[model samples]
Target chain A: MTIHQTPSRLVTIADVAREAGVGESTVSRVLRGQGSFSKRAGERVLEAADRLGYVPNRLAGSLAGNADSAGSQLVGVVIPSLTNIVFPDLLRGLTGALDGAGFQSVVGVSDYDPDREEALVAGLLSWRPAALVLTGLEHTELTVTRLRAAGIRIVEMIDTDGPGLDIAVGFSNRAVGHASARHLIGRGYRRIAYVGHDLGRDLRAAKRLAGFEAALAESGLALHARELVGDRSSAASGRAALEALMARVPDTDAVYFSNDDMALGGYFACLGRGWAVPERLALFGCHALDITEAMPQPLSTMRTPRLAIGRAAAEALSAGSPPGTIDLGFELSEGATA
Target chain B: MTIHQTPSRLVTIADVAREAGVGESTVSRVLRGQGSFSKRAGERVLEAADRLGYVPNRLAGSLAGNADSAGSQLVGVVIPSLTNIVFPDLLRGLTGALDGAGFQSVVGVSDYDPDREEALVAGLLSWRPAALVLTGLEHTELTVTRLRAAGIRIVEMIDTDGPGLDIAVGFSNRAVGHASARHLIGRGYRRIAYVGHDLGRDLRAAKRLAGFEAALAESGLALHARELVGDRSSAASGRAALEALMARVPDTDAVYFSNDDMALGGYFACLGRGWAVPERLALFGCHALDITEAMPQPLSTMRTPRLAIGRAAAEALSAGSPPGTIDLGFELSEGATA
Candidate 1:
């Protein structure tokens, strides 16, 4: 029953099995890393594959299209930024949980552009991933259409401003803003300003700003000065924005940053100026990063459940949980800065 | 046209065309996101796809068993860690260069395990990526065989310890270790201890440690004390390791960490103990991260060409550079630490 296949043709599982003198299912199990195969059988298949220079035709097997195409055990994760410690923390929890459960993560960074997110979606969807984890609920029309059309689980993470397409796992960015404003106002801070990157591009940051303004209006106070930088949110940007804002409004009492990255930079700026923290200038940030806690004074920021959300999302996806929202609320870390 | 098709069957490009009243070529162009298609035709295809719930099977068109697969213009990048700033910086440079060249990045984290790396490689390769970028040269036997057999371009990155599978783009880890040791020894420090994670797991770090020990042996001196921790490199680990090392051997004058993370933690420990840097004990690290420079006293470390290597690897892969080693050297920053 030996069938001689042309070497020029794309190598198939059967070709590998025939070359290795094994059954088709053995080759499939060994290559796909599924089912129980003897170590000897695995080694045989690998040796044959190496000798024959066989690269399995993954498309024809795993991606043949349908509900049962031997689909991948990969959860496609799309986030805004990799350098942002928040995203990495989230990924750590997710991958840790998923890997333990024999699942994997294929990650993509959207850079906070909804259009780019749409493109990333198209490419990720082409894989027909078991489930997809997106940064927020905001997505282009085509992105929504494609996900619904693809009929796979969708998990929107980090923000819960609106109804999700499928599953949602995060606190409202607006709520984080309101809580931050309340904390700042409760601390008797007036003439407050903001230091952040582009609010328009980062829709969640924009929503937070709206919530901050609303909370501030309740106290009959408004932002005195604000500095908007480019797309990237960095400590350098934070320092620069603080310098500019202070120059424009010397009487400014406190500044709420978009995140801890900027706040850490502002801390350095204060260090350079020899300003007494919370005395000359108080600072508050979001996403209490590990680096933030390691600072001389713990950063006055909200401790969002980044890692918890990731783990929960992975667990839910693994359990084949129905589409719904799971609100993992944020905690206020009223550190020395505030 | 509009011949009704059963949704049960996996939709193909041909099906999309007939449903949209367009040619198969037009549907191919639109769905593959290549070449050009008229706006009207693209809209018609999308509308028809949306109406018919067509999920284009990427495997068929993108993995047509040859070089002509309309496979996504994505480069699959596999790295060791996400929290490690070095990897992220490298990714930033790579994605920037690749993005400008009309390519996107699909990333996976290996957690510094070769076995996990093999699994990641399998999943990523399933996409038939345009190119593959991996962390180091020390892949498992099967991984090497698989890469050689896959026929796609391979770039072994970060460390050039040995020969690459296809292309190698990085500095020599041994060279870095030698350089670090030379710099420290040149400054007349003999009683140096090493604080690192599980060296048995992290081959690159082990190489660096070997180079360091060899240099020390050449100078007729051995390490005073070495404290090994769990299989994770972190500032906390560094702090704890330094504390343990100091408690074990109080006379140690300098410390060489596996990377900047351990060094930063040691720096924090020095800060907590009210020990002046470079006076009480000198510190040196590898991979001079951005935060290293922004420190009150800039860290004394080796500034590896992380970003440059990434950009070079991307440009080379994009330009189809022949399989060869591109040695992007490292720089030693003689700061207050050492």
Candidate 2:
């Protein structure tokens, strides 16, 4: 009676259960909207909770023994960049699927640092997330060790060049790179240059570079010159790299950028210099992002299934599907530029 | 001794404390990288933790009474869109400052729904975040009530059209609107139209509309036509909206879009139709996003200090500053378009 009458202290699950003539768990399940409950019991619990002005602290309830630990509803997503539209598009697909399934995405950005990624993964693991979604397969040894111990549903999104920790959902960058190189070379571009930002950090970009070079070697050619910038990918960086590359290798007939950002920059450089695209120098990139399509001359790039990858990852996690790789292939857009 | 020797079960703090010959609280602080302790004590704690292979679960330690509840190190940042580059830029600014400060931003997207925002706020609050960073001042009454009760540092970013519940960052949308209207008017554009997406949900856009209209009224000219979109703002939406509005009010001199996405769309529409920009239909927008500036004819828009707002808010939060407003103003970029 005294416990029920204590107005100074906030109402707890015990108080609601006692008032409703039910166990503590019945109140919790009904309040959390998790598990199953009888209609009359749920009604009683709600009515009692309402009468007591009980506001459930979901964090406390999450760790409580009665709550289903598997239904934590938190999926940790660690990506390379939030600034890039690619990651956000992936997030959109993730939220689109997960929102209805009663799940929320907790995001962390690594900014393309392996050590930082390791730190972020450890921090996310501490949250005891239901699952983990990370970018690429590359991780510190310590990170791999900890993740193995965590034993959560691990997913590596966006790139499938190498092996994933557990579940991998995305296309093969190597294939995309080979295709891009074949397309550009097949279109009669011999003297080609590669322009990219921080290839060392973006391992996927490095993999693409390898694939491009391998395909180029098969055609008895090599890059005229490669310009690398140690910065985040952006149009400005792309423009600067293109300008420097053109200055260094004046005879280059085409340029393949790591991604669309550098490609956009390269395009801007052409516009600035009044150079006829493809007529003077051809340009190509990866990732068919929106602005690339919106450009006056549509960017010749590969359309990767960013959103589909996110949705598949989430749906699989929700369904308690076994660990496997899902390879959603890419399509090359042979636009006006190339 | 047995507690320290158990390999099947995870090593607990008790085992570490016993091994280190220190209190559990001392061990927790050293492990969590929080609080202060003697150098000798820290060394002992680390050695014990290393020998025992103790990986502290942050979620458990967060609510554990021994840990500092205030230093959760998780700041909840709720924004409208990750699709739009604006939010990401804001996040970049925030994380830039907060990263070095040993804080991680736990993000949630409201998608411009007040009801959804209220729900998200409730969910974020359950985590008992160190701070709550929201998009706008406008929130559901219940949201405000709950925020008041949460007793955490509350920050409203992006818009300053109304009184904030607590700390307000970013520029005034109303002022930006008026300034934009005046700039166009000063450039001798009389017939103007507005293209926006979901004004009812995006209160800031609505406020801008009000300011734009008010400034127009002073010039004795009302908008030629207003096209409102119910969908998310995108380049395609902008292009479609411009086409519809142009077909409806073909003689309109200039179009004010909600943001750069719509403006970029309008610009693209002009490009696609081979219509001359500014001469045929002037395009103006808020937010001088990256791609906007990189366009062939740079977008005539205001450059809001998105990054600065984020940095200031984080800096203040780090410093434990009092509740107030930090108004980072905007700059108008008079590009070739308008």
Candidate 3:
């Protein structure tokens, strides 16, 4: 059965009025409840409208036809994924601020795809939003062009290491990585392995890994072995990667995962194999997630200020004053695992 | 200094023609490239259009003027949260199917808030969507009334125990909870505690917890202790709750968390306090998330069919099928912890 059908000819108030043998003004008034109509005339117009399946145009609310031109009414946010709690925390701050200003924010997920980011930017700009809030300073050449041409405020979130396309709100991922590595080295872990997902997709993770390796290199100790997964990092993948790394490099005393998910996997793998954490093998991660803290052993990790980043992004965008950087720093949560 | 000003009025084709010193038909021809116009006239029309900031109306596109009528080209989806991987997985399926049908899906987050869901439904219905897909069977009295009156196809997802307000497509959360409890009990875990957040808000989590209690009660084993947080369940809250529960109920050998986040928290709490998981305490959760599998010892839990639920809901709405239930079962993954 046909769920819906399109009329052969467009039905309008004029058509309804003509069919009901009334003026267009009369039909419009009756439909909008703006003016009175004779009961007989109203019934005839209503019957004609029902027969034609005519729906009144509310394109003009109290705001009239001005709806489409309001640039500040729509805020466009482009992020990598919502699966990670960090993004949600960031949005909590952004939405809290923007909605209060009567601005409705729409989101697009690129899944760490630069081409997709470019495409999303083009689509979001078509709405002519007041601001574009994106994750990271890294962008494809096309994305940069469209964002610039869109002539809207841009806020790059979750990293403050490099020159931003516009305003930047986040911590230095490199610093986070360096701090993590330094913390591990300070704990007297000489040999360490790295387990992570595709750094190509998550540039922030790559920066963190680079800084981690740099700190280790300073002590004449490089990564013992790095086990990588070419997919989105999760607890399951982290566990599998850690298991594979242990079998390949059993001498490694500690392992630093790309994120908490991977670290949790490494932790579970240790539990399954009856390996004593910190004694036989140490495990460390980024993102001081609540789960990490709750694990039988709290995960040794860094807590990026996700909510702060989001709030700052909205504040910076709304200020419409200047383009600069705001470093929302990270905190190290030294749990029992490391 | 106004960051947000009331939007300016729209300039119609008539205004553009008036500014360009041309007839409306001639301006339309020049703008749409549908009919012939002099080069001078075309240039004049272009300049006037640019200066006036006139945008072509898409309301007259392939599916125009259906905004207030039934059979609108819109599909509305309401989900709990994307921060969890579940909703995104569901969207992957829904988008893959609906995008091909020229039906644009607009999403709203209820945040498990029934009042918010009710408001969103009213807003979405104003667009007169062809179909409305919402999460869960449980809805507010006002929500049920408005939806019933909306005269649109409705599909409630991720539940199957109760009667559908329309179409229902999901598995039984209670069954998943029961299975998890039975699995832990079979492993000789007699002293089991529960770690959860506001069950009143998240009905699915509440159902799981209820089923778990029912199963445990059958074995003459009631929950030893429960750490209940009157907020959304988070990993950090879960970790804290587990720690608190362990302190109060030292004899508790296992814990059934409301979901994976709580379970992960419980796992971390054990880690922080130097408790041996599975040996001293067993941790079980639901949603057999990817992170759970990645941890050193995989988390023993059930994996809900989130993608299937989403796909089924979209398909049912699209097909205009009668209201019924679709039971996409959950999976029990047994890891070393349980």
Q: List RMSD in Å for every model shown.
A: 5.2, 4.1, 7.8
**Per-candidate DockQ versus the true complex?**
0.29, 0.39, 0.23
lDDT of candidate 1 over B27-141, digit per residue (tens): 8788767888889988999999777667665545455535443255657788888777778778777876886676656677888889989987876666667888998889887
What DockQ does candidate 3 have relative to the true complex? 0.23
The reply for model 1, stretches above 4 Å from the true place, is: A1-11, A16-56, A65-75, A98-104, A185-192, A246-253, A278-280, B1-11, B19-56, B65-76, B95-106, B123-131, B185-191, B214-227, B244-253, B334-336
Identify the leading candidate in terms of DockQ. Answer: 2
TM-score of chain B of 3: 0.81
| lDDT (10s digit) by residue, model 3, range B1-338 | 22433235445678999999999888878977877889999999999988765644333321333444454555777877656556666765675466445465556667788987886676565445678889889888867766665656788888887999878898998898899899988999999999998888889988998899999999998988888998677788888888888889899999999988778777777766888889999999888776776665678989888777777777776777787888999888887788
Per-residue lDDT tens digits for candidate 2, residues A89-185, read: 7877786677668666667778898888898887776666778889898899888877776667898987887778788889888888889899999
**Model 2 regions lying over 4 Å from their true place:** A1-10, A18-26, A32-41, A51-53, A66-72, B1-8, B21-23, B32-41, B66-71
First chain TM-score for all predictions: 0.85, 0.91, 0.80
Question: How many Å off is the CA of A284 in candidate 2?
Answer: 1.6
Regarding lDDT, does 2 or 3 come out ahead? 2
lDDT of 3 by residue, A40-65 (tens): 88889889987765654332221233
Model 2 residue B143 CA deviation (Å) reads 2.6
Candidate 2: true interface contacts recovered? 0.38
For residues B1-338, write the lDDT of model 2, one tens digit per residue: 22222134456789999999999999988986789999999999999988866776555656654233343667888888888888888887887788778776777778888888898887777676778899999889878866765667898998777788789988989999999999999999999999999888888888888999999999998988999878778887888888888888889989999989889888878877878988988999989888777777889998999889889888988988887778899999998788
